[model samples]
Target: MSIARARLAVIIVSYCNADDVDRCLRSLARSDLDQFEVLICENGGEAAYTNLLARLVGPDRILKRISNDSDVLDLPQKRLASVASCRFQARANVVRIGLAIDNLGYGGGVNAWLEPLLSVPDWDAVLVLNPDTEVDPRALSELVAKSAAGYGMVGGNLVFDASPDKIINYGLHWSRMTGRVIAIGRNAPVGSTPSAENLAKIDAISGACVLATRACVEDVGLMAEDYFLYMEDLDWGLRRGKHRIGIADKAVVRHIGGTTIGSAVTIEKRSDLSIYLSARNSILYARRFAGWRWICHFGIGLLYAARYLIRGSSSAGKVALAGLLDGVNGKTGRPKVVPGAR
Candidate 1:
């Protein structure tokens, strides 16, 4: 008989956000959780990320194609899709980095690490984190604790990376009565002191920093690849509606929102692209789980988009439009990347 040690796979997904990735990796090296490996899915440049990731995880753990062997079509699924750590090395808590063949956007990028991690029968959980996030030293510990306590999916409190004292997302809530999936901890002041309730209730946790158990994923399933760039976390959250989602009050991570999706757009405006996704995904979300409430939810989304376009800044207006349109066509994946005209 053998005693199995708990194992965690940390997947960092990024594209052209090298600066943020550097800080994120550095911050992660300080985490209290020791039984883990860090796998970075580089949708950006392999050369640049190689050295940086090597410091935290180790050179052998970092996986990617050399500059001379770059290929585009085989990205996402191809990026670091294997786990080669022996029990002894993993018990020591080492992290590995991986680079994709092509950019797999959001959901796909994270899933790529699955191929490698899942193959390792002993690995217990996969924590998908955006590379632009900076987390507290105790963040990993808190998430791990939450899972062991039995809440399959646990999330950390995210704050604005630039302003660590500002709340980004604490947990999410879905009010069946109002047909709203709310961010329960949004706008809460970030500080040393806080109430118990603030950490107690979670509606839907975001993918920016989430801890997913192997059991939860196998039963509820992985994120849908169709939601390439957004809402996949919330979508996954809905799948586990019967169980209470957990949030750690002490686990704090700073996120530079939209580092990969470009700048933050205002809630208003008709960018066409963004509106499409917001609209389409919202409809898909409502219909998939909310049943009869889909229509009402869709109408609410329209009003939400309308008000933004009518009153918010021009940029905000564009965001409203882009999200709506993106939702409608079932359009997902990163916005097209264009080369500069230098």
Candidate 2:
């Protein structure tokens, strides 16, 4: 089926960041695409986001009951006359807001919405977008176009929300040999373009804004739920078999990197939770994919911990060490909250 004619479903998982979700929904309201649906899986937040969203998208547009399913709440559809007409408009799009009963981690939250969608065969593509992101109006369209062009999974270029002109990642490259996951264009200026050869293919796409075909998801399976937070994207890509992954540079998303867990400004300022999960997940990823080469993975982790300690990040080093040990012992799920963290 042609992507343009095919139905699209966008799933955004949110955790206690109502304001960020508001901004993200407003941006999506401006999408140039004619037809699509947004399924927002709200993972435990104290604020009454349903009411907040009603105000943003209008109460009349908010649906009371979507289905018998306890997990999903489908929002009402309000026709949008034009983009210049209002701040929030449901338009021709169907918006389903699913309030998760608990605080499911990233992958788990996504699966909350994804599982139900998978049962229905109408969708051609599914876009997993981060809540703390404001996508370019053309972003989804570009991603869909790429999916229709035969790419199994396609990701958009992500730029820092604070410094919109600085590139965060074009795509990701994971080296199984060294157990390293590198962001292709970490700190390059936004306008700088890569050579065609460099843009030809990528090892993995950022989970920040990934678009995948139904076929890809069916083949690769859902995002690894075991990875509660990080490295799930690389795992999904690696498991794609012979499917090609590509980046749509024309599709750009402004992302607030750590709105829920990490530092909003830079990766260098990652929080304890971010550090712990990343450290643990890296080990888990290697163990699952690398087999006997897991020893090399452990060595690389030791080097990482040493670098953190040498750089005077004692907390980072300590958490990383604890995480590595926990992963080796097969511990998983949300880590205990670091003291004094709100």
Candidate 3:
């Protein structure tokens, strides 16, 4: 399919981040792409959704002034008025918002929003994006262009929101020997001179912003629900056998990493939830794909715990150890409390 004719749907799963959702919607309103639809799955319940609506559609007019045409989308009748449509010349594009009754985690929230759209044949591709991201004007267009060229999955260059000049992730590199997943182009400075090597095939793309064709989703399936948050993208990528994964260098996104889950900059400040999930899911992913190499993955978890203990981060150490044990014991889903919390 050609870029102009291809139908695109963007899904953003947000949890308790009204400001971030507002910013993301505003950025989408300014996109260079002629037409597309956006769905914001607010997983923080009715309160967060109310705050988000105020920010996006309030008298302040944070989003661009756009006409809401009734026939733009055949959304559920109850929330049809909530869908924002922009009249760009003769074409009407849509922006729909919905609320989850509870916190559904990242993957569950996305699936909840996406399951309804799967029956609609209008969209040719879906872009799953984080609320804590701002896409460049050309980002969606470039991603769609790659999808048209037959790449099943595609990602944009991701830069830190605070340090836009520095690259945070181009994609991911997974190692079978050590059962490790590493972000490519991490902390690399964006050079004044552009390099052809910027575009390449990658093992996996960051879940923060990725585009997938309808055909790919049908074949490989949706994001795994086993991982409440972390490693779900990696698992999806691994399952997409032999399908090409492309990194579009021109498509840039500024991401506020760990906005919902705590910062990685400081050990103490890191959220117990983030540390626990990362440790638990890494082991689960390895067991699913690495065969006998799963032992190495378990050992890596031990190393993380040991390092945390050595650094006097007892809480983080305890969280990691607890996560490792849970994964070994085949435990999954959200924990009742913060792992290792008394």
Candidate 4:
């Protein structure tokens, strides 16, 4: 199909960030496309649902109250109960908001939406976008164009929102020996493109902005819920059987990276949740994919936890150690202990 006629479904997993969702939807409205829909899973529970409703509908009651179950939309009525459908910011895009029963992490939140829509033949491609991003007007078109050319999975150029002129990643580089995943072309000039060799080495597209064709989704299945937060994107790429991945350089997205988890380039600045999940998932990833290299993965995880201690982030250090232990025990799904859970 041609890019102009391609039906796209944009999926966003939101957590306590209705304002960010507002911005993201506004940017999406500028896309130069004829047909598209957005599916959002508000993973922050009841309070977040109210906030999202207030932000999207104001006081006019464009959509009915949540507890009034009779008013709910029936698009994905299986596991979820109060999924609501509405249009935001006067756009033609059909926005469906699914309320999560609990905090389902990133993967589960996305699955809440994808599981219901996979069989729906309306959408040609699915673009998983972070709620904190603002896309260039031409970005969606470029991605659909690449999808039309038969790329199973595609990623666009991501730049830091703080400094839009500097690139955050062209894609990602994974080290099997050390269990480290690094962004290719990180902090490089925005206009710079990676060499073909560098692009070929990309282990996976960063989860921040990944576009997967419907067939690819069918082949790989939904996002893995084992890791919950980090490393699942790489896991998805590793499991892409026979499907090819490509990059659309013209598709630019400005990302306000790590708003929910407090992730940062420097270890000292990362939140406890971010540190723990990163450390835990790295080991989990190695256990799944790495052969004897799992030992190296453990060593690297230990060093990372130690770095947090040495850098004086004692809380983060403790969390990282706990996560490593949980990972070693093959614990998966939502963590037992969470930030401020006490």
Candidate 5:
């Protein structure tokens, strides 16, 4: 595929954050690349759906809701009634909005929007970005350039939005022994540059900003929904078949980090949902890819629970234990219990 001139689809999954989505879209409007369409999956229900549409379309203009057998997709007849609509309408395309029937998590939300477009021949690549990120003007262009160079999957440099001088990660490094995933170049100075040779050796690309060729996506299939929240990116990188994954160093994205699930660098700031799903998904990852080492991964999960308990966070400890039990018992999909204050 001649990706340089090939049109791509940008998929953003938003949950109860219209303001962030608005800001993200405005940033995309300043991007150098214009051959792309935006697909948004609103997983936060009716109120969120309405608020987002209001922000994008203004109070007077209403977008019509189009429902199919599977889910609700809202597509406006014309371009969005906003100043930032030019980028979306560059190819005479209206932004496609998907209202998820339920909270489909990250991977499921992405798959929801992608399933319909699987047969569409217009786009050659799909860029999955979190709605909380703001891309630099050249970021999209850089990603397309890398994709054109033959990399099947690509990611950008993610930095903390609050402190742009600090780094989040170029990609990720997953360890099979402890079932732990570490962010490469995490907390390093923003000026630090990693060699392309090093960037190609990562275990997985960060999910915050991943661009996969349509061929790669079709080959590897949809991301596993069993994880529901975390680890799906790693799973994708692991199951990428013959495709190669790399990082586009010039593509920079400012990330507000984890707001939807209340995840933070510290355990004290993490929400119950973040803690639980991460623990449960690690075991699931192990069971699928760790072979006989799956037992060791379970042990690691137990240790994580004990560590939480020992650290004097009983609520988090209990949540981790619940996740470990669910993981070992072969539970999958969304969590059965609602994750809130215990």
Candidate 6:
């Protein structure tokens, strides 16, 4: 098949959002292109949804990327660039499902499941979609077209899946003073740049939905699995900074974030694994790619975060401080593997 006709895979790394996964697959099934394949990596599920999905989509449309993910979390390290060994099927767009298996955290899980399809000879691009999302009909087309035009990776406006009016991510802006990261920009309208260049110039878009080219993988390498979950997208963006590629406004997606963490995040409290990971990962991100600027970036970030935690933020504070010390001390320790931690 021609490059244009080459299959574009969608990797859906699921955790516990069964209802959201159902909605996500339903949207994908209703897509204009029915030829694309779906790969469900059922990592750690009490009730396996892949079987139900296979029944709904029929076996042919669903490619079982991993059989009986009995101990999907057995070897976390194995999920990294190490899993890039499985080959892709011809003319097939494999959408990896990682729900019932071990939680590869964020980066590890996504990279692990996608290894199969990215191995394909004619595979052109892979779209990573969070499970709690309702994708726009033209999102796939926009991403593929732009990537083909020489933009290696692209991102788009993310409307909140719950409330479409308020955008979840409309690109990102780096605050010079507060050193805080902001999502969504004013004067948002969709189209290519004035020069008709393909890549989106936005500083940082949400990973809730991203369309990445094969060359981007070759150039930047895979997502850093060291971070169990948070900041993987920022790391990816930082890597692309080396090559000057970035988000594409043309690729539009709607996202429902924080599903992997827990619905408890909706509460006002700021102490938990969710908050802990965010605090820890921020420091981890600084150590890996930021060099000296990390000091300024994270210092301001700590102050901004302190405003949130105010009185009850001691748990996250301790985790963040510990992680920062570990990072600066040249340890950069891996997260202590909790037996059932995803």
- TM-scores of the models, in the given order? 0.75, 0.84, 0.88, 0.91, 0.87, 0.72
lDDT of each: 0.64, 0.73, 0.76, 0.80, 0.78, 0.55
The segments of candidate 5 whose C-alpha lies over 4 angstroms from its true place after superposition are 1-6, 59-93, 338-341
Ordered from best to worst TM-score, the candidate numbers read 4, 3, 5, 2, 1, 6
Using lDDT, rank the candidates from best to worst.
Answer: 4, 5, 3, 2, 1, 6
Better of 1 and 6 by lDDT: 1
lDDT of 5: 0.78
- Give residue 140's error in model 1 in angstroms: 1.2
lDDT of 2 at 256: 82
Residue 332 in model 6: lDDT: 31
List the lowest-lDDT window of 10 residues for candidate 2: 76-85
Instruction: Identify the leading candidate in terms of TM-score.
Output: 4
Model 6 TM-score? 0.72
For 19-133, candidate 5 gives per-residue lDDT tens digits of: 8888887788678886876788887887787788777764333223222222122332122111122123223334566677778888988887777668556678999999999
How close to the true structure is residue 281 of candidate 1, measured as C-alpha lDDT? Answer: 66
Task: For candidate 6, give the lDDT of residue 330.
Answer: 48
Residues 44-100, candidate 6, lDDT per residue (tens digit)?
443544443443343353223433223222122344222211112222343333343
Candidate 3 residue 256 Cα shift, in angstroms, is: 1.0
Candidate 5 deviation (Cα RMSD) = 5.3
Tens-place lDDT digits, model 3, residues 1-342: 012222888889888888888788777777889668777777777777778777666445554335443342434323222343332223345566767656777887777656766765667889999999999989899899988898999987788898998888878767888877877778777532223454343568889998988899888887888788888898888788857887677888899978888857677778888888888888888888889898888998899888988999987899988888888887777777766952
lDDT of 6 at 86: 18
RMSD of 2: 6.1
Q: Compose the digit string of candidate 1's lDDT tens values, residues 1-342.
A: 222334887888877666677677667767787777666676655664554444334344322322211322123344553322212222344444456666676777777776645655777778888887888999988888888888888887789877787777776665554446567666677744335675455556788898888888777776776766666888778787556677666788888776565445544222344444555567666666677876677667767757765674545444555555554555545556211101
Per-prediction CA RMSD (Å): 6.5, 6.1, 4.2, 4.0, 5.3, 6.6
**Candidate 2: TM-score?**
0.84
Model 6 poorest 10 in a row by lDDT: 81-90
